[model samples]
Target: MNIFAAIADPVRRSLLEQLAREGPTRVVDLTRGRGISRPAVSRHLRVLGDAGLVRAIDHGRERHFELVTDALAEVSNWTATLTAKSASAPQPPVAGHHLDALGLEVRRTVRERGTQPGTRHTAASSTATGEIA
Candidate 1:
């Protein structure tokens, strides 16, 4: 399953949070007061392991699980990519100096909206201003 899908489960996510906070922990230690059986925790761990969110180490008889930092980085990177794309939408630049003017207008609109300037621009405003070069 994908990282998102694996993390969609409250139990699995909780397990991950606990691992992150507590460091490499045993399955038995993870199950304490969770209102779930050891087998159930084991199952969730298995799913997390499959998704590469957790790494399991066999220490003699007991297995210890720890959070895989890189897996969380993937989620962070994916969100950052989407934010970058949406914040600067790929509309083709208007021809010539009009592009600069349009950029200024975009900044103005963003400032008016109380958001970071130039994050968004409107076609109607440019058209009305006869600046659609």
Candidate 2:
């Protein structure tokens, strides 16, 4: 299964989140807040491990699992590129015109609301005996 599909399950997502927050932990510790049995949690961890979402290390007799941040970064970059491409595409005139108009309105509002002349307060001026209040 793809990484997205493997992580779609709420249980798997929770496991990943826990690993992210608590760092490496044994399967038993990981399953403490979960309602599922330890074996079920282990199965979810196996799927995550296969998807490169989690990595396991031997700690004495037990295996500690931790999130593979690099793998998630890969996923993030892929989605970011896809979104950038979609956002940069030239849309139909109606949509493009709407966005252009929105941009202009925002700029106009900012310009209108900007600091007016003589509105600035300066500490040196306030202390100067000859300066206007």
Candidate 3:
């Protein structure tokens, strides 16, 4: 199952949140303060581990469960890309000067595209006056 489907259950989400806050913990530790039984908690942990959301590591006789941060980082980067695309779409200018500023910014960005391969460009850096469009 996908990460979203695996975490759709409230119990599973709680387990993840707990692991995020409390660090790696044993099954007994996870279910101690929770309202569910140990077996139910184990089942949820199994699903999370399978989905790569939570990782289990052997600690002595018990297994400690912890959040898999890399999975969350991938999700965050995907969301950020979608948010930036929607936010940057063209819209009607609020004033006459706004359209001119937007045009200049776009032109400057195009001009800077052939510079060094590793060079970084911000919205302000692309503008002649160092102001964001």
Candidate 4:
């Protein structure tokens, strides 16, 4: 199961929050105030374990479940990469106003002039000037 999918459920997310806040806890303790049966909690835990989000430890007569943060690092790294890419990418110029539209049109014409067939370029045309053609 995907880690995101495992955490997609409210119950599973709540269970993970509990495990993180309280540390390793048994199914009976995790079920407290959750309004869900022990079996349902166990099922959710099983999915969490399968997703590598949590691990179950055998202690004495009970199995204690705890958050496995290493797996969560994958999610954190992916989100960080997305944020970094968005931060570095160039943003479009702010919209509205005829000057902005004119500026865009000027840039578009300049760029397309090179690619368009039969578009003659001279020394005067290549030189940068305040006036737009």
Ranked by lDDT, the better of candidates 1 and 2 is: 1
The lDDT of model 2 is 0.85
Collision pairs in model 1: none
Q: Kindly list the per-residue Cα lDDT of model 1 for residues 1-133, writing each as its tens digit.
A: 7999999999998999999999999999999989999999999999999999999998999899999988888899999999999989976656768978988887777777555653444677666666573
By TM-score, is 1 or 2 better? 2
Sort by TM-score, top down from the best: 4, 2, 1, 3
Q: Could you tell me the lDDT of residue 91 within candidate 4?
A: 67
lDDT at position 83, candidate 3? 99
lDDT string, candidate 3, 38-123, tens digits = 99999999999888999899978889999998877766887899999999989765877988898888777767674443466666
Report the lDDT tens digits of candidate 4 across residue range 4-110: 89999999999999999999999999999989899999999999999999999999998999999899997899899999999999865764586778888877886
Candidate 2's displacement at residue 114, Å, is: 42
Best by TM-score: 4
Q: Tell me each candidate's TM-score.
A: 0.63, 0.63, 0.62, 0.67
Stretch of 10 with least lDDT, candidate 4: 124-133
TM-score of 3: 0.62
Where is model 4 more than 4 Å wrong at Cα?
93-133
Model 3, runs deviating above 4 Å:
94-133
